[model samples]
Each structure stands twice: as C-alpha cells, then as structure tokens.
Target: MFEKILIANRGEIACRIIRTARRMGIKTVAVFSDADANARHVRLADEAVHIGPAPARDSYLAIENIIAAAKRTDAQAIHPGYGFLSENEAFCRACAEAGIVFIGPPVEAIRAMGSKSEAKKLMEAAGVPLTPGYHGDDQSPERLLKEADAIGYPVLIKAAAGGGGKGMRRVDTREDFLAELASCQREALSAFGDAHVLIERYVVRPRHVEVQVFGDTHGTCVHLFERDCSVQRRHQKVLEEAPAPGLTGKRRGEMGRAALEAARAIKYVGAGTVEFILAPDGAFYFMEMNTRLQVEHPVTEMITGLDLVEWQLRVAAGEPLPLKQDQLAFRGHALEARIYAEDPSKGFLPSIGKLLFLSMPADGAHVRVDAGVDEGDVISPHYDPMIAKLIVWDETREKALSRMRAALADFQIAGVASNIGFLSRLVACGAFAQANLDTALIERESAVLFPPEAPPPDEVFFLAALTQILGEQGVKGCGRHDGWRLNGAFSRAMAFRCGEFENTVEATYLVEIYRFALGKRSVSARGRLTGKMIAAEFDGQHVQAVVVAACGALNIFLDGAAHKLEKLDPLDVAAEGGSGHGGLLAPMPGRIITLLVEPGEKVEKGAPLLILEAMKMEHKLTAPATGAVRAFYCVIDDQVAEGAELIDFEPETI
Candidate 1:
C-alpha cells in the first residue's frame, strides 16, 4: 500500500475515502476551500491543506494548487474522490507528469470515456448495445436539429460530459427542440465547459440501472452486480438500491456480462460504472460510462460487503483483482436516500444557511450515514447542497424500505428547509409503493406534491398557540404546575400567519392550555426556565417538547426537535413584488440571482417559474399547472427570505 494519499476533493466523499484509507494504514491529506475550512473531512484527515477560495473553480478544481499541496505534504498518490477533478483528463495526465500516482483509472481510460460523444462512438465500435441517436462531431444548430428530426420528435439532448442531470433536456416537439437544445448547450458550457452535445431517443418509462466493474493493471477485471437507480427527479437519482427489485436472474446476468465486456473493450482499470437506460419494452441502451466512483456507490458497497475505494487504491497500486466475477455476491437488499438541503414544495430549490440544529438518524450495523455537515456549520452557496447520503440495509428490500421511512421521520434539521418531508411523501405514494414508478414519476405526480396553495391546518396553528401559552406558564411550583391564577386573567390574544392568511388566536391559560370558546383540549405542560423539557399529558400519551426563547418570536422545540415561529403582524403591509401567495415561493431562505418570468405571460405548468441560484445549483422553478401569469412578486436581483411568497394566483370565480 502507498504510504500516504491526498484526497483531491471535499465533503462527504472526501470523508468517505479517508476512512477506508485509514483502515488500510495509509495517511490521508484533505484539501479544503474557504467554505470547507472547518468541514468534517478536514478535521478527520491526518493533515489538511488550504487550497484556494470558496468557489470550486478556484479551489477544488485548481490543478496547480492541488499538485503543490500534494507535493508539500509528501503524498505519494492523489485520490480524486468523485466530482471536481475526478474525471478531468488533464488532471490525471498532470498527476502522471508530476510523478504522483492518481488513484483512478489510467489517463488514457479517462480521456476515452470522459466525453459522452466520443465514448458513444467508442462503445459502438466495441459492439456495446447503444441507443439509436446522433453522437457526431457537428456543433451547428441546424445540423443538430436535422439529426434530432431524423431520429424522432421526442429525443434527449444530453451534454457530452454531464452528470447530476445538469446540461440535459428532453424535447417532445420540433418547435421545442431548437429552443431546448440551445438552453441545454448554455447550461452544458457553464457546468462542464463543454458545449458539445448528443441526441438520443428518450426512452419512455425508463429505468436507470448501472453495473459496477473493477479492474487492475494485471489485466484482471470483475463485475460486482448492479444497482437500480430508477427513482429519480429531474433526471437525477433521488434513491438507489442494490439487486434491482424487478430484475430477473437472466436480465441481471446479461447486464453484468455487457458491463464486463464494455470494461474489457476499453482495457479499463480501477473502479468504473457502465450506465444503461432500460426502457419499458424490456430493452436496454447504454447511456455512458462513468470513469470514477458514483455518488450512489454506498448502496452497492453495503450489499457486496466490499470496500470499493480501498479497491480503487489497491488497483491503482498495481494489485491484482482480489476476487473473480463469480466470487462477488449480493447479500441483503440495500437502499440509499440522498438528503439534500432543498425545498420540495418550492420546486426542489436548494436551501443554504447555518445548520442550527443538525441531527442525523441513528446508525447501526445495517444503517450508514455519509454526511458532510454538522450542527452550527454553515451551508454556503459555494458548494453542493447535499447534506448527507443515508443508506439502510436489511435482509429484504421491503424491510430496508420500512427502516428507511422510520429513520427519515426521526432525522431532523431546524434552520434550513429540506426535502425530508417531500421525500417522505414520495416513497409513500401508491405508485412508488408498488414499485411501478419510472423517470416521469415525479413530473407526473408533481401537481399533487407541489400544490399551488398549501392548506394551513388551523388546528396545527391552534395547537401552536395553546402550546405557546402553556410554555409561558411561570408558576413557581415545579411538579405539574398548571396556570392556576388567583386573579382571573384568562384570555391572551395573539396573531400568527400560516403563509399569506393571518389568524388571531385567543389562548386561555387559566388552568391548562386552552383555546377560546372551543372547549379546553385540557393540555398541560410543565417546563423550567432552565434546560429541562416540557410534555403535554393527553389520553395517556405525552407530547414531549422544549421551549428555547420566551420571547415574541416563539423559538420552539417540539417532539424532541426544534423549530421557529415569528409573531404574525396583522397590520404589516404586503410587498409589491408579489402576491400574498402564488408563482414560486422560496422554499427556504435564499437569494435570487436571475429572473425568468414576467407578469401577463402564458406559461406551461412546468415552465421555468424562475431561476433561484442557491446551494450551488440553479433551481428552475416551474409552473404548478398550466396557467396565465397574472403577477410576479420578486425582482431580478432580490434577496428572498425563506418562505417569502413570490407569485399569486387569480381569485377563483364563484
């Protein structure tokens, strides 16, 4: 084994590599940008290096800084832990020229598989099953349009070097193709610095499944089963599982062989993934090859009981393949959920801020958490918004899913808005439960998920007011102290807003917490001014809670978790930039960088509502249902506070 290796990446993957490297008795070097100066990975590594500024291009992607840091630390090898410079052919070549081992596939392999266009051509020549489309060298818009027309009206415009669903667009009509193609190109150039693209037949009801293959310099290679990444949103995977639920033994064998054959054709070494888009017709088409570790690799690792990163290092060190293809076995089922700092209600826009109350679900032998942030840490706009990847394993797929749902409910974060609530609802959807889901699952069911106006349960607000009054109980006696007043001051009027609508809560705190007129729910809670918690006893069950600040904005901690609610201002004037509610609301607090919509415009339900640049990715807010834009509430350069209403729907005709 190498003496030391520098992790040329940041966040959870960097932390993941360091753990395995440590187990192998190897010293690890962690590189950090300004935003990640106090990151978990930096603290865990044996030594750390300050690379550059907070921006990824200046820091994580800077080859010179990375090389200098590696040499200064006397590191023998550099592990490009997925993303950043992970698949950059120039970086791999630079490592070779600098006399430092790059713990990945050879530079030749990286270059051959880096560009999707070239990779498609290479794979076709190697006789790998490919989707019928255009993967040519032409960059002319006219030529690309002609190719798309020749292929079909419904075609996929994909970036030559794309992942994470960036720089990808699907067109269903000829008129839309030209416009969407241009948009895809612009996004592609911005994301990958590559304007090249290819068109493919968009598979209807597609299932994204990939094979994990590994090779060594000794000319040995093996395939480690496959992972079903069918559950996706915006063409990006939200959940992944090992041993594809509906795949038969024959289909699994065929995919495994095809993956191995593709690897052999490329003479690939180190860990690589061959992705395929499986259509409803029971036929599969090669999407492209990923020349580095995958974000969803944890699920595969759990099922196979193999340390893929350690294997990457061993293979890069010229070790022979540890196990043959047949030796690799799939044990129990494993599933992973990507926990992102995003708001599902606001079209899944990224959220950024301090993690005031960060808590991960408990971990055990079957559960694994690959996280990057902790409590009090700031989630800046300088990097990806993925807070963590939670993985669960069990003897059966259903068992794993059951464990995951329970864990998700227990997972908590206070300051920033997250997709936990949305994800919880998605996995529980009827179609998802039956596993009859596809790529269009999210889009088809988006209306139900992203309701135009969320119904504010007045009961919940009433409960909050009642809970608030109980929390203000200042009785001196400690044990079961109810608000027993010698004097008769029973009712306290308070204002609160659910979203745009305002409500006045008349709370009576005479005996137990009670609502006005509505008979006392007879709720009693006792909390001390100190750190002790309070619980409401009702029907032999306790609603455990903690109240932090005894002030105007009620900072509350309910059900062993904390949250904030401001005192609603009934007299506050509504801002002109938007309706009281409608268009696109800021899911969580974030600044708006660009505007994509205007008033009196006709927009498809899924049209770009606006471009909210946050948590590092541009979240394109789309229409909820096809409607004419009556109003826009935000400006182009507005700094939108979280949950600030940005659009308004026309009043319904009676």
Candidate 2:
C-alpha cells in the first residue's frame, strides 16, 4: 500500500479519494488551482499543493505541474480522480518516467481505449457487440456526410476522445449534418484537443447501462454488476442506479460477462467502466469505455458495499483481486442523483455563484452525500458544475426510488440555482417511478418537469412575512411582545414581489397569534424563527420551513421547493428596466467560439448569432426577434464575463 498519494483532481472526487485514503492510513495530498485555493478538498487533505492558475489548461490539465506536485509531497502514487488526466495516456507515461505510480489502468490500456473510434474497433475484435456506424479515420467533411447518410438520418456524431456529454451532437437530417458536424468538431478540439470524430446510428429510446469492472495486477478481472444511467439531459447523466431496474438475471449476467471481456481485452488494471446502450428491442451495443472511475460510482458502492477507491488503491499497489467472481455479492438496489449548480428552466444552463445557504440531507444507513463545496463556497465557471452526489440504498428498487424522492425534497440550496426541485419532480414522475427510462426521458417528461412557474402557496408568503417580523422584533430586543396596546392591535403591511407581480400582505399581531390578509384571501399565522428554520402555522395548518435572506431576496424553502420572493421597499423608487435592450448578453463567463452572423446582417427570430463556450459546453446565443446585427460586442476567441453584451441588434418593425 502507498504511504501517501496525491489526488490529481479537485472538487468532490478528490475529496472522496482523500476520505478513503485516510481510512486506509494513507496520507493524501491535494492539488488546487487559484479558484480552488480554499476549496473543501484542500482543507481535507493531509497536505496541499498550489498547482497553477484557474484555467484548467494552466492547472488541472498541466500534466507536468501535477507530477511535480506529487514529487514535492513525496507521494508514492497519484490518483487522477475522474476528469482531468485520468484517461490521458501521456500522463500515465509521465508518471512512469517520474517513478510515481499512476492509480489507473496501464498506459497501453488507455492508449487502446482512449479514442471512441479505436475502442470500437478493438471491441469488435473482442466479439463485444457494437453498434453499426463509422469508426474509420476519415476526417473529410464530405466523407462524414456520406457515412451519416449511409447510416441513415438521426445519427450521432461523437468526438472520438470525448466523454461527459461534451463534443456530441445528433443530426436528424442531411441539411443539418454539415453545420452540426462543424460545431461538434469545434467542441471536440476545444475540449479534448482532438478534432477527430465518429458517426453512429443514434439508438432510439435507448437505456444507458454501464458495467463496473475491476482488474488487478494478477490479470484477475471481475464485474461489479451494472448501473442504469438513462435519466439524462443533453447526453449527460442526471440520475443513475445499480442493478438496473427491469433487467433479468440472464441479461445482467450477459452484460457482466461482456464487461469482463472488455477489461481482459486490454489486460486492464484498476477501476474501469464498460458502458453500453441497451436498445428497447432487448439488444445492447457497446458504448465507449471510461478508463477511470465514473462520476456515478457511488451507486455501485452502495449496492456492493465496496469502496471502489480503495479497490483502485489496492490494484495500483500491485495487489491481487480482492475477491473472485462468485465470491462478490450485492444485496440491494441503490440510486444516485447528481446535484448540479444549474437551472433546469433556463435550458439547464450552468448557474455560478456563491452558495449563500446549503442544507443537505443527513447521512444515515439509507442515505449518503458526497460533496465538495460547503456554504459560502463559489461555484466557479472554471470547471464542472456538479455540486454533489446524493446516494440512497434500499432493499428493493421501488423503495430506493421512494427514498430518493424524499431525500431530494430535504435538500436546500440558495444563491446559485440548482436542479433539486427538478430532480424531485423527475424521480416522482410516472415514467421514472415506473422505470420506463431512456436517454430522452427528460425530453419526454419535460411537461411535468419544467412546469410553468406559478404563484407560491399563501403559506410561503406568510412564513416569509412571519420570519421577517420575528427578526425585526428580535433586533428590538422585544421577547414575547404580543402587540398589546391601549385600544388596538399593532399592524403593518408588507409588500413582496412574487414572480412578476407585487403582493401586499397586511399583518396584525394580537395576543399570541398574527392575522395576515392578502386581497380577498386571509389566514392567521404565527411562527418562531429558530436559526434559519421556521416552525409556523397558518389557519390551523402546521408547517415547517427554512427561510434564507440573501442577494437582496428572501429564499423560502418549503415542501421540497425553493421560492424566491423579493421584499418590496415602499419608499424606494423602482429601477428602470431595458438596460441591455436590443442586445444579447453573455449568459455566463466564457469565450466566444464562433460568430454566426456578421455586423449589419439581417436574421430571423431564433437565428443563431454566436456560440459561447463555458463550463466545457457550448451555448448558442440567438436572435431574440427578426433583427439586423448592429455590431459585434465581442469577437471570436474574446473572453467575456457573465452579462457582458455579446452583440448589438435592432429589431425590425412589424
């Protein structure tokens, strides 16, 4: 076993590695960029090293810096926790040359499976079922189009070296093929530094099922069962589960055998995942193999009661397999939901900001939370926006689903937008609860998941009002003041902006109760503020809620959803709107990748104006209406901040 190991990644995965390392009595070293100087992983590690600037290219992906950090800390091994440098063959060789163990598969194995196209060819040779497509080394646009046409419409163009949903696009028609191909290539080069791509027949209603396979130095490889990652958006997984629901014992054993074949094919060592796309027709095709640990490995852990990180450490230390195939046993079903700093309503765009308040569900026998950021930490745009992995286990899949929904409801986040509410609705959705899952589940169930915003319940406003009243009275050092007066009860009106309209609620404090009236509706409410928590009642209905006041707004969390209501100041003048009228602002901090329209060019509504690359994904800024481009505020390759004007436009008169 290694006396010490350096984690060559940041955020939750690095923190996760450290916890297991500490338990095993191995000292852990963490490397951080400028953005992660005070990150939780840094605080948790036994030793920390300053790597480089915030940009990943200058820090996390800078292979030399990571190697040097490991050497400086006297780390016997470096664990490339999932993302950066984890599957890079060059990084593996660099570690070898530096005389430091790389806690992953061999360099030869990485080289064999690093590219999707190469991996497909290898899998085909090994008799692993493969989807029909083009994995040839044809780089010409004309060649790719021909291949797409041959493979039929609605084919998937994937970056040969891409993972995590980056550099992938599905083209449904020949008219859109070339344009989509160009966009895909650009993202691939930007993300993976490789412009090569492969074409595949996009499986319809396919369920993403991947097998967790582990190999040791003794050439012993075994499967740890499978996880269903079909609950996804934009080709990225949102929720995952182990012992994929609805798979028969025969199918499970088949997938397990196939996964072992993939591992043994490369003489693979350490932890790796063999992903497959299961068609609705009961057939499965090989997807790409992830050379390192997956983001959703926790579900596998929960089911098998195994620590995958520890397994990786042991394998990297040249230990034999922990257990043979039959000895390995799994008892129950497990589910994991990825909590991200993103807004589902805003097309799931990344939401970056400080975490003003965060309340996670308590970890117990049935639930666990693997998190990297704490309250007050910023979700910088420099890396992936995943907040945490919420995992739950139960005796059966149905119970696990029920547990997950409840756990999601217990989650609370403020400041940055989160997918907690969306996740709650998703797990409770009929299709999901019934296990009718697929890659298009999010789209198919979009109506229920992204329901139009409606006014919050009256109790929410009452709680907010009560919380404020209690706070103000506390400041005045008045305890138990029941608004006793000579003749009348003390009363005041509070105005709050809910959604788009301002609502005023009149409150009168009398005796030990408070009466609230809003328009024709009224309710008597009284509540006590206890450390950001409120135990309140409205019209004889008891309720519990959490209210957080930050960013000039009151965030009320109740019934598994967060509602933001801004308290209106009666004496304050309203600020004028239209500050960026006739302009398209950058939604987040990113670099302009392409200019789709030239200045003075006329375009129709929904026309793509330009592409902004942020958080390792591409966001297209489009024309708000039929308009002529007035000017280009930021050119291609220009780095722009969030809300910076990217283009100036003038809408045409009707």
Top model number, TM-score: 2
How far is each candidate from the true structure, as Cα RMSD in Å?
4.6, 2.0
Give the 10-residue window scoring lowest on summed lDDT in candidate 2.
475-484
Q: Report lDDT per candidate.
A: 0.79, 0.92
| Candidate topping lDDT | 2
TM-score of 1: 0.87
Give the per-residue lDDT digits (tens) of candidate 1, residues 1-654: 899999999888998998899999999999998888899899999999999998788999999999999999999999998888999999999999999999999988898888888888888888789999999898899999999999987899999988878879889999998878877886777678897999998888888889999989988988999998888876788988897878888999988888888898889999999999888877888899999999999999999888999899888888898898768798999989999987776557677887766668878878899988788787776788888999999998889888788777767776677887677767667676677767888887776556575534444445456555554555456554354567864665667654464667665655443434323443333222344344554334445554433334444544433345567765666777644335457765555655566777777667776766554345666677776668778877687776788776443222
Count of backbone clashes, every candidate in sequence = 6, 0
Off by over 4 Å in 2: 477-487, 570-580, 600-605, 625-628, 650-654
Off by over 4 Å in 1: 451-484, 499-505, 510-534, 545-564, 569-654
Least well predicted 10-residue stretch by lDDT in candidate 1: 518-527
Per-residue lDDT of 1-654 in model 2, one digit per residue for the tens? 899999999999998999999999999999999999999999999999999999999999999999999989899999999988999999999999999999999999999999999999999999999999999997999999999999998999999999988889989899999999999999999899999999999999899999999999897999999999999898899999988989999999999999999989999999999999999988999998999999999999999889999999999999998899999989899999999999898789999999999999999999999999999999999999989999999999999998998999889999999999899999899999999989999999989999988888878878878988888777755555566778989998888987776778899988889899988898888888898889998898899988999988999989888899999876778678653448779999999999998899999999999999998899988898997999998878999999998888888876
